[model samples]
Target: MACLVRSLCDSQPVARFQRRCGLFPAGGAAGEQYVVKNYFYYYLFTISAAMGQEVFYITFLPFTYWNINPYVARRLIIMWSIVMYIGQVSKDLLKWPRPCSPPVVKLEKRTTAEYGMPSTHAMAATAISFTFVAVTVNQYKYPLELGLMGAFLFSTLVGLSRIYTGMHTLLDVIVGSLISALLTALVYPTWDLIDHLMLNSPLCPAFCIVVPLLLCYNYPKLNHYSPTRADTTTILGAGAGATIGFWINNRYISDALAEAATHHVLSVSGEMLLTMLAKFLVGIGVLVITRQIIKNLALKSLCSWYKVSINDHKALQQFRIEVPYKFITYSSIGLNSTVLVPLLHKLLGLN
Candidate 1:
C-alpha cells in the first residue's frame, strides 16, 4: 500500500515548471496512474484532504471565533487570506498541471482541472495550524512543544493527503508548505501591531473592505477558465467581512472583556462543554440560514441588475455577476459569524 501510494504520488506530469527546467519526464499518461483501492487508506486520506478544504475552513474559523478566541480567529483568518491569495495567484502564474492519470490516479475531480503547484491544500494547512500556534503560544498557558507538535502533525497530514488524493506532486507539497512557513515568519512580527490596528484603528474597516475587493477584481487572469478567481474572491470577501466585523465588535459593541478575551484559555467541563456544544449548534444554524438567504438574494439581485437570466450558468460566471454575489454572500456570513451570532448568544444566554 505504501509503495503503491508512493508510486502514484511521485509520478509527475511535465507542467510549465518541468518543461522549462526539464525536470520531469513528459511521457506520463492519465491511464497509467495508480488508484487507491484499499478502503481504510482511502477513507483516511479523504478525511485528511477535507481538512484543507472549504467546508473545513467555514466550520473551523467560526468555531474558533465563537468558542475559542476572536483575537486568535481574527489573526487566523487574516493569515489565511494572505497565504491563500498568494498561493492561488502563484499557481496561475506558474501554470502547473496535476500529475498524469496513469501513474497518479486522481480520486477528486473538482480541482483536478485547475493548475496544481504549491498546492493550496498544503498552504492552508500549514498556515492555519502554525498561525494558531503562533497566536496562542504567548496568550495561553499551554505547552509550547505540544502545540508545535500538533501543528506539525496537522500540517503534515494535510500536505501528504494531497499526494494521496493525487492532486499534487511531492514537489508541490514541499513548496506549498515552505511558502506558507516563509509567509508566517515574515508576518508574525507584525501580528501584535496588526491586531492593535485592527481592533482600535477607526480606518481599519475601510482598508479591509477596499483592499480585498481590489485584490479580487485585479486577480490575475488565466488563459483558460479556472475556479481560482472565484475561489480567491470568496476568500477575500470572507476576510474583509470578518475584519470589519471585528472592528465593529470592538469599537461599537464594546463588550467589556472584548480586548481581554484572548488572555486565557477556554475551559471545557460538564455544563460548560454542553453549553459550548449548544453554542456551536445554534451559532452554525444561524450562519447557515444567513448564508443560504444572502446567497440566493445576492445572486438573484445581481442577475436581475445585469439583465442576465438567473438560470444562465455562463452568464452568472461573468466578472460583475460572480464577484458581487460571492463577495456579498460570504461577507454577510463572515459578519454574522463574528458579530451578529455572538450577540445572539449573549441574548439567548448561551454566553
Candidate 2:
C-alpha cells in the first residue's frame, strides 16, 4: 500500500510541477549534486519560516496578550485557530505528498514527512498578520497603508519560505493564503459580536471549551499517522483556555483590574522599555513552569488511567492520551497568559 501511494504521488501532475519548479536535477547519475545558488535567501527564508513555527507562536502570542492588548491577542488566536484547523484537516482529507525530494532539495527536513497540499505556514501568516491589521486599525492610530504593507510583507515572506524550504509547492501556498484571507473576511464582521459574547455572555466559556474538545476528538483519521491532529489540538486548546480566561477576568475581576487588561500605549520610553522586557522575561518564565508542571501531571494521570508507561512515546500518541494531555497543558498555559500574568504584573509593580 505504501509503495502504491508513493508511486501515485511521484506520478501526479502537481508533484511533477513541483519537481520542475525546484530546478534540481532529477534521476541524476551517481555523484551528481545540486548546489544552492544563494546563501542569502537560504538564511532569510529560514528565518521567515520560523515565524509560522511553534517557537514563534509561543513567544509572540504571550507578548501580545501580556504587553500589547488582551483584546487583540484573543482575536489573533481565534483567527489562527480557525485558519490552522481547516488547513490541517484539509491536508488529511486531500492526502497530498510533499514535493518529491530528488528534484526538490528539502532544506527543512522536520516537516517533510507531513502532507503539504495547503501550507499551514501560509495560512497562519496570512490570517495572523492581516487579522492584526483588521482588528487593531480602529483601536490604535496607525497609517492604514503601513499596516496593510506590513501584512503583505509578512504573508509574502511566509508563503515564499514554504516554497524555498521545499515543504510546499506554489499551489499549496496560493490556496492556503486565499483560504485564510476568505476566512478572515468572513469572520471579521462578527468580531464585535464574538468579543461581546466572549466578555459578557455566560455561554462563551462553555462553548469555547466544549467545541474545541469535540473537534479534537473527532479529528479526521488516516491510515498513516501524522502530527496534524495533535498540533491542531494544541492550537484549539490554547485558544479555548485564553477565551475562558478573558471571560473570567471580565466577570469576576474588579473594574480596576479589568482596566489594566484594556489599556495600551503607542510609545515606550526607556524606563517603560525596561519594564516590558522584565515582564516578558518574568511572564514567559512563569508560563514555562506552569506548562511543565501541568503537562507532567496530566501525562502521568492519563497514563495511569490507560495502564501505559509514561515513557512509552507510542502509547502517549494514542488519540485518547494525546488529545487530553496536549489540550490540558496548552490550555493551562493559555489561561495563565491572560489571567495570572496580568495579576503577576500588578504584584511585581511592573504594570
Clashing residue pairs in candidate 2 (N, C-alpha, C atoms within 3 angstroms): none
lDDT of 1: 0.82
Off by over 4 Å in 2: 1-37, 256-265
Q: Give the TM-score of candidate 2.
A: 0.88
Tens digits of per-residue lDDT, candidate 1, 301-350, equal 88888898989988887788888888998898888888888888888898
Off by over 4 Å in 1: 1-36, 262-266
Q: Write the per-residue lDDT of candidate 2 for residues 1-351, one digit (tens) a residue.
A: 987545434424433433444434334442134454555666778899999998888889889877777778878988998999999999988988887665566666567557987899999999999989876777787888999999999999988887766678777888899999999999999987888888899898889889999999999888866888889999999889888988888899754444333333377699988988999999899889998999999999999999999999889989999999999999999889888988998899987
Q: Poorest 10 consecutive residues of model 2 by lDDT? A: 23-32
Task: Give the count of colliding residue pairs in each prediction.
Answer: 10, 0
Largest lDDT belongs to which candidate? 2
